[model samples]
Target: MKKYFLKLYQYNYWANKRVLSALTSQNVSDEKILSIMGHVVAAQYLWLHRIQGLPPAEVKLWGTYNLPQLVSMAEEIGTRWLQFVESTDNFDRELTYHNYTNDPYINNVENIMIHLVNHSSYHRAQIALLLRQNGFEPINTDFITYDRVITGQWKD
Candidate 1:
């Protein structure tokens, strides 16, 4: 399970970079894309902090960040997640944290990790759709695509 989570994190990181690169190359100023990416980064950070038993209020849930800032945050969070997956021994361990509305809840570390990845993928798809609507060809960020690249089956 640890190895599986590690691979998911790695794929998350790779897909984020691909999207960021595509956005940067376009040099387009799209508020929707930026906002969605910012939310993705912010949510990831919030989950990481919550998993570490920190207050979720310390991170912004809907903060505005430009492309460069979002890219940096994504990279940093990716590293943090990698370290966390590698170091944690118990995925089933429950963590208690407050939601944005200050509502307290308990959740397992594994579920939170899965939600984080799925959340990012959901937002990334939105970004891709927005990019396509804006007449820009977005990068393919499918997990299978990343797997092929890593396994030397796809050249990008």
Candidate 2:
């Protein structure tokens, strides 16, 4: 199960980097796309902090961040997640945290990790759509695509 989650997180990190590269390479300056990416970065940090039993206020869940800042944050958080997942032996370990509305809830580590990946995918889809609507070609960010690249089945 830890291996499975680690793969998911690796895919997440890869997909995000591809998206960021596509946008940056084209010099995209769309505000909506930037905002969504910022949100993704913020959410990743928030979830990791929550899993580590940190206070919710330590990271802003919807903070505004520029693309360079977001790229840095994503890289740092990706490393942290990889390390955490590698070191953790108990995915069922439960954590207690408050929602944005201050409502409290408890969840296990596995579910939180799953939620983080799904949340990023949701926002990434939105960014892809926005890029297409604005006459830009969005990069392919599907899990199978990442798998092919990682397994040497696909070439750049």
TM-score for all models, in order of appearance: 0.95, 0.94
> Each model's C-alpha lDDT?
0.87, 0.86
Counting only residues 3 or more apart in sequence or on different chains, how many pairs clash (N, Cα, C under 3 Å) in candidate 1? 0
* 17-68 per-residue lDDT for model 2 (tens digits): 8899898888888888988998887888888877887766355566666788
Best by TM-score: 1
lDDT of 1 by residue, 65-146 (tens): 8888878988998899899989987788888888877899998889989999999999999999999999998889999999
Per-candidate clashes come to 0, 0
Q: What stretches of model 1 exceed 4 Å from their correct place?
A: none
Residue 22 lDDT (model 2)? 90
**Candidate 1: what lDDT?**
0.87
Best by lDDT: 1
